[model samples]
Target chain A: MSEIRWDLVKQNWVAVAANRALKPNDFPIAKMGLKAPAAGGFCPFCEGNENFTPPEITAYRPKSQANEKGWLVRAIPNKFSAFTLEGELVKTDSGIFSCYNGLGEHEVIIEDPRHGVEFHDLSPERIETVLNIFKERYQDLSSDARIKYIQIYKNRGMFAGASLEHCHSQIVGLPFVPQENSGLPKYYRDNNRCLLCDMLAQETASEERLICKTDHFTLICPYAPRFPYETWIVPQRHCEHFADINEEEVRDLARVLKKLTGVIMDCLDNPSYNLVFNTAPVNVEPEAGYHWYMELTPRLLVNAAVEIAAGIYMNPVAPELSAAMLREIMS
Target chain B: MSEIRWDLVKQNWVAVAANRALKPNDFPIAKMGLKAPAAGGFCPFCEGNENFTPPEITAYRPKSQANEKGWLVRAIPNKFSAFTLEGELVKTDSGIFSCYNGLGEHEVIIEDPRHGVEFHDLSPERIETVLNIFKERYQDLSSDARIKYIQIYKNRGMFAGASLEHCHSQIVGLPFVPQENSGLPKYYRDNNRCLLCDMLAQETASEERLICKTDHFTLICPYAPRFPYETWIVPQRHCEHFADINEEEVRDLARVLKKLTGVIMDCLDNPSYNLVFNTAPVNVEPEAGYHWYMELTPRLLVNAAVEIAAGIYMNPVAPELSAAMLREIMS
Candidate 1:
């Protein structure tokens, strides 16, 4: 489980997970983009090694038992979760600092049962199943009054912070809305327009930063990317929540994601990357200005002090160039 | 040099450094935290290899000629700078996007001629010299009307994004104030109190999070630290600019920094770290609420999607515990 603490100076909440020292393997010494060791030996996410992990919370194993080997996908609680559901969500003051019990849910979505499979190699059907699980979890977690936001993300390689060499994604249901989402609702209230929608219209129209487009989705390198070869997969229509996505959107997203990720792996020589889902908070009423999107950042370079101190990013590769390269590869 | 791009969607500015791909050495494939390859082979930052880099911008070489091997500390324009002084500082709108010619200064401060020498190993007098160079550069750059903020940071070890093995620091002058500093002045205006001064009072009074204290400065693990073992060196008295540091403060800071960094290396077994200096923007009038500080973050864990998307940090090691460990080691 984890405890949430309020940063008095920065005015933000920090989740502190316990038992981090117990998992020494999570902190790798290797440079991030290298191929992680195959999970053939003592792999927890492997189908037969289900016993190594905590019991399954939910799985798409229609034909097999709850914790059996016949599942295409599975969901389990993170063993060393940053936030947990054990303690009551009570806020306490320690001098000038405010802290809450580590009260939230942390779950891992096993993309596949294979030992060393990557998400791009997964079949569209399997990816769709993963998307379905994400939506299901988002909906279920939103029902809890205590959970304000559910963050869904995937760390592909060691550099992107993937401790286990397995095809998996994480879902953290937090007790408070993250700082990034705080100003979004107000923007919608003031402008009556979705910021992403306006940007997407311009990006697609220019076609300079657009990598690919499908019926329901558009993929483009962001104008001001934080990392080199940073890409975004945005829904064609404005949608506030990931759970509100339709079946067509899900299927299209799966196909687009598979193609885009394959291109990224090929273009960047299989760079370590992080894929994050940005959606509106559950507690807030869905607003027109809030649009759900996914940002894919390739870990091509290391972040230095400028990034940490100023919140300013220095990207080496221009988005236009990266997008042109991806477009050429896709063609 | 670097080009500045505006992220209309996120409402932030990004610096895009060009010619990055030409320098493959900047992107190392070896595992982080490992002893980088020694300075024996074609080390651009080494003293004798002055021809390998651009001519020195400024150096402390009193006995030796310019571009010669006689300097103890040297300053040079970054060969592959993210932002440069080559362009006119003009912002133009392209559709919904705004971009400016990357019109700023980027310099590298060679801390020592020896390769693989960490900051903690340096003598206090040498550290003071380095601090003097930083203040000198800050004061010099502030005279340029085009520059707003000067970011001083050091990326040590491979994971901390130090591409070169030699001990050095970077200074980047930007055309605009970063998003992180934008709120502080307004907060000060509204509350009529210096946020950091209040924080220092609370932290020093509590003593739980205080790692150490000198006559001029206090080192404490912030109550809401974004990373594990994150520490800040804050001055005892309120100071808005790094250039305002006096001779005595510089000497004390050098001593405190040496001791604190040594404690960190001892406690974390020489973990990769990033050290950053945060100060008020030059364009703004100095305010009582704005206090200058330096932050040191150890790269103990990898940041995944939740951190990137939500702006929420999950620190596994609590500040209090880490502070206590450092205090114990110091004793």
Candidate 2:
């Protein structure tokens, strides 16, 4: 589990995920494609090698035992979690500074049983299973009064910061609402309208940066993307909470996600990318003002000094050009 | 030059520094140490190869002609600028969204004539020259009423986003104050004290994460560092602007910076790092409520899904431990 500390100067929270114990040289090179076997000749998430990992919390093993070989997908507590299930959420104040004991859940959803397979390579059924697990976990974690936000994200390659080669996504239940999402609620209050919904309508009507559209979802390169080939997968209808998504919506999202990932892989030659789900904070009921979405940022460029210092992003490729390239490849 | 566009949804500005038409495959591998010669066998920043870059804005060439070989340091307009000097500060409104032409100055400060030498490796006089040039440019650019902020930053290696291996730093004059700095003025108004000055006093008294101390500066790994081995060099006095530094302060800064970089390089084995100068916005006079400092972040870890999505950082290494390790290496 991770411990959250307050940065007095920046007025933000910093999470120290100390369980990983990664040293300065522990970071792996940004390698693409398949990864070699572990030193012990074991892949924990593999079907038969399930014993290598901790026992399953919940798994889709209809044909087999709880922690058995026939499972297609598995959800387990992250071994090197940033936030732990243990520890009391005690906030301590020293003068003007404050810190809290990192009391939250960190779970890893093994997307597939195969070692070398990627998310896009998984079958639609498997992808749907992954989405269902994510939704279930979101609802379960939201029940906890201590957990305010649940962040579900995936890192596909080395550059995207995946230490393990196995296909997996993470769910981090945080103690507070993140700073980035702090603006949405106020924006909603000021305009009685969901900002993303308005932007989606404009994007769909313009059809300039639109990559693909489905009955349930709309995928487009954002107008002011921080990175090249950055895409957003948003629901056509406004919804505040991701857990509120229905069965039909889940299936549609899975299909659209597969198609979009395929397009990105084809266009960027399997570039390393990160997929992040942006849902509303917990304890807040579904509202008309806030809408949930997922943003996909391909790691084509490195963020350096200017970005770190000023919080300003300098994108070398225009969003219009990236969208056109993706569209051409999709056709 | 780069163009700035307003992201109405996020309520932030995005800079499209599209002058550098970098392709998807243009990003170089994370190469360490000295770079190999380019295929053209010409380094654009080398003293003799002045023609390869845009004309010099200013250079310390007392003995040679302008744009000739004998300069210790040079300042040139970035050929691949994100913001140009030509555009009018015109804001256009389309529905709820707003955009403005990127009307700002982007210049590159060639730190030294030698291609392979790092900033710390340069002589103190050379480093002082670089600082002087930075201050000169900051003072010059702040005179423009349209420009509100000037960011001074250096990306040292390939992973740190340096396109070329030659030693250089960048100065980007922006048309507006960045979102990150917007909180400072308000915080000052509410608290009646500068946030950084308060932080500096606490950090110095604790001295737990202190790396080094000088007459004019105190360097420490911050209490809540976003990255491992992240360090900040803050002046003891409550100076709000970098341009306000006198000659003695500049020389002291150059000496302290060289020592700190040497410590970082020794501890991390020449890891890629970014040095960013945080200063007061233009037209803002020096005040007790706001102070300026430089933050150094080494690119030892790759930021991925969770960090990008949540705006929360989960650092594996603690600042105290990193500072202790750096202290040991320094000793």
Candidate 3:
């Protein structure tokens, strides 16, 4: 079991997972991104090299068998799981210090069977299949008593933190809720409303920061984005989790998400980016406090040393301006 | 005046300053770091090219005039400052949204007149001179009621966010204290003790994560670090700010910091890194809540897509192991 150590100063938990099996010297010579796919190059997530990865947990197969070449997408346990399935989560508090066993699940959803394929290349139907699979996985693991938060996010390029060139999204069932969702519950307590709901109302009314709106989703550039082209996809229904999103909503979301990402790729010249699903904790109580959404942040600048170290950002571009550019490109 | 907008979801402020004058088109072609300094490079911070930079705010001049040829170190307003000296800081709140004018100070401390020099290349006494200038700047503006926090940090390599090849550190005086300093006040209210002080006691008592301890400073690997080889330098005197340190303490810190950076460079193959000073807000009330410290984090890895997008981190290396390695290298 991995140990989640609580940072006394950060007031956050740091999970020390041994699944990566990294040595002390690995830090000095860690190579990122995939090698060229030509000339006998091997990739674990590729079609013929399925044996290099852990067995498939689930897959969307139309003609072939599990872990076979016919699959369009598949979910596998992370080779180095940050949180494993077999562990007892026992919180230990000594004075002001606290820690717990890292007891949950870390899985990867390989978006495409073909290596080096980008997300935008996938059809809306294929993206819809991926979303459906993600929903199934969320609903599948929500019943587990140990898991509290599930984060589903994608990293597109090396600068965006993708270690491999294969198109994949990660799903991690954490034992506790990370601070990203704290605002919703707190806003509900203070204002008796969902935070994103009010934000949607404000952005829609103004439309200054609005990029585009679909039947079920509203995409807008957040008012205070840390990144240059940071945008959010908020569901109009104010749902608490992605698992709760219906079939129709999922289809609409797939279209909205696909178009937005494509626009970003065209506008930013295909910059590295991260896409995250901000869902409520598993079985959030008084669920009106939360409104689940998807956030896309482009890694526009490479010099984030200041932002990373100080946690203070000096954004060169305004969200209003970025939204206008995105809307222009989107049209 | 630049605008500092509040993020409802992140519960943080985002400053949009014109100092950089970055248009939306710049996002597609912004190059980080610097070109090779070989072909008679024109660095505004270089010794002979001082006229290219904004006029000097202050400098350590045993010879030559202000912004002139001979100076070990100098402080000047950033050519594209994130915050500025001319603006009326006003908070505007409507419903749940809030914003303020980006009215503060952003200065660059050219640590060396020579281009492409590393901090470790400077002598301890020379580093002490730099530290003294940082303290002088901190105390200089701390009296202004509009300024609430001061951040002094260095981004060494391109990966670590340095835009120029010249050796330099940044000093930003903000109109508000950032969330980095929020933990101290919260802990003080709950525990009636400084958080870093308590952490120091635990790390010192165990010495498992201790790298090196001096009379005035204790350098240790934080138990929970977001980055690989992250170390913290906590002052022993329980001071609330770096400006509060004495002359002897400054000299001691300069020596300790120099040694640590040297060891890190030697061990990590001269990895790009960020060093930050976490000082308290100006004139903190019931000052027991804060303790000043410096943190050094190596940019050993480039894939921060997950850490940046989601606030969760899975640190593969444990602090104990990293500290052991550092100690071994130092010995």
Candidate 4:
């Protein structure tokens, strides 16, 4: 089983395990397309197509500056980046105004060397290796004084916003931590309890809505689900950082994730979905409470004006019903 | 010009204006061909379709019975709501346990007698009438002592979760205000300044990102846009609630909205989008340093794992560029 940790500074939860699912190849097989490719035909992430993207920032390849030949997972600068790497993180406040230059590193982590191989489809060993790489990157980025937060996430399938078919996630190092994010951990501190930990215990005890569970983790459609089929994967035991899980936990996580994905695929005829690992900021360590976890949002509804107007969500299907349906399908 | 009020409670800004541009036939037009309709389709809110849903609690039609439909905008109970109407709003202290019932009202607002038109395409006069209806509903629902907040919003198109193409937003009156929402107002009170006011001032002053402006409002792409082409419409002056806006401002809003929609349709090639209004809570009255506004999110990018995990938007195009493009195409 994997351990979940809540990052105090960033207020995100992450799962840490060494025995990650051994089967990454199934990642691609479960995806159903809800969106089409970009109008232009060029896909920069594919193999034999190194020229389409900016120069590689870093890669686990041979020391060749020529092309994208010898590489496992590579990191490249985004062609259409929101924030470039050139600016300095200069912070200045004009009276009550406070802001800094949008300076930091935004690098894309390519998971597979080949095209059409999503993360879940990667081998278990490869998945573990990928997890290690993520930790290493987190550690490396935290060392930089200017960087306040490091974000890692993958967009699979067309609906999940995969510009390219290859499996990958992008890591962004930001200069300033977002205000809402910073408030989350403080909330835990003020309440004298870990928000997620308390919530998880309640959800677990109320097993009427449990979707699936593994040795290390439990997957359930949340009571206050922001979207229909919004499944949350929380660790049975609370930990904080994602980079600190053991091998057994990782393996358990892999098993659980595979099953969760399987259930999703089996039901809803393979809807487009997003899988996100919410870990704490690089600067903060796990404390007395708080836990990290994964939130899976299936694109079952469109987020329109009303949703934007109110922060509250309007999930048509009840969480209990969704859980029941998922359990039945998984069984 | 519409007044932009900083919500002292929600920490969000909203514009109160009756200035709206509504052509008689103008309404949100759903894209053709997304999902397969039911085998034997039925209009769930129609007069005879009462049996299709759970017994309605309140209806406005020639009320021989409450559920019977002669109402302009019908409010019926959600058959499969995420949150139930039952359950006590109990906050127990079971050794650091904190979980509340998913207890709240989830009512669907059916817009038209005919099932053909969306809210966006309705006549200006008709839209104003709908706004009145929304205001009436808010006033009525918020009076419930159990309800602390009333959220009003609409979803258009299948992408936006409109089960029926008829125009309407759902109202969910919660027992208590959510933490994320409540914190915004607190931050405002502590800082003694409006967060959105500062944001809008910075954006308007930048001029580089300003898209379109009406006497009552200014539409600009946010500086750090969470999504590509994320346009925000704000009133030039500060005000609070959406229902409090005068008739003139509504007309101005209608014009600006029509122009904004035209630009989105023409410039982004009529991409699917979500329009959300950020307003103050039900109990909160208009106060200094609070503002209300509308956010238009064009679904240009699929918000996948990276965005969810990192809490940062990866915009493919800069706000400046997007604004310029929109300015070129909009009315």
Cα lDDT tens digits, model 1, A1-331, are: 5668876555567887543432222346433333344443477888888888899988998799988789989999998877767655798887545788888899999999987788999999999999999999999999998898889999887678777878999999988777664445656777776677887899888999898888998889888888888999999988888899999999999998898889878767777899988888887655556788898898877676777677778887878888888778765
In DockQ, how does model 1 score against the reference complex?
A: 0.54
Candidate 4 per-residue lDDT, tens place, A1-331, comes to 2222222212232222212321211222123333233465556676678887788866766565545586777778766444544545565464333344556666777878776565656766666666667767777777876776666666655555665566777777766554323434765667776666766676678876687777788888765455556688887777766666678878777666666766665565555577766656555444344366777777555555444444444444556677777778765
User: Model-by-model lDDT, in order?
Assistant: 0.80, 0.78, 0.80, 0.58
Give Cα distance to truth, residue A197, candidate 2, Å.
1.9
lDDT of 2 by residue, B115-176 (tens): 77888898888889999999999999999887888899999876677777888999999887
lDDT of 3 by residue, B1-331 (tens): 5688877776666786523435534643244335447787577888888888999999998978887889989999988776667656788885667788778888999999887678998999999999999999999989887888888999877667666768899988888767775678788988887888888888888888898788899888887787778899999888887898999998999998888999888877777788999878884454567888999988776645456645666788777788888877754
Kindly list the per-residue Cα lDDT of model 3 for residues A191-245, writing each as its tens digit. 9888888988988898888988888888888877888888899999978888999
lDDT preference between candidates 3 and 4, better one:
3
What are the runs in model 4 whose C-alpha is more than 4 Å off?
A: A1-42, A55-72, A85-87, A92-98, A178-239, A246-260, A284-292, A304-309, A314-331, B1-41, B45-88, B92-97, B179-225, B233-238, B284-288, B321-331
What range of 10 consecutive residues in model 1 chain A has the weakest lDDT sum? A18-27
lDDT of 2 at A276: 89
RMSD of 2: 2.6
Q: After superposing candidate 2, which stretches have Cα over 4 Å from the reference?
A: A17-21, A29-42, A284-288, B17-22, B29-40, B181-183, B284-288
Which of the CAPRI classes, incorrect, acceptable, medium or high, describes model 1?
medium
Q: What TM-score does each of the candidates earn?
A: 0.93, 0.94, 0.95, 0.73
TM-score of 2: 0.94
Give chain A TM for each model in order. 0.93, 0.92, 0.93, 0.76
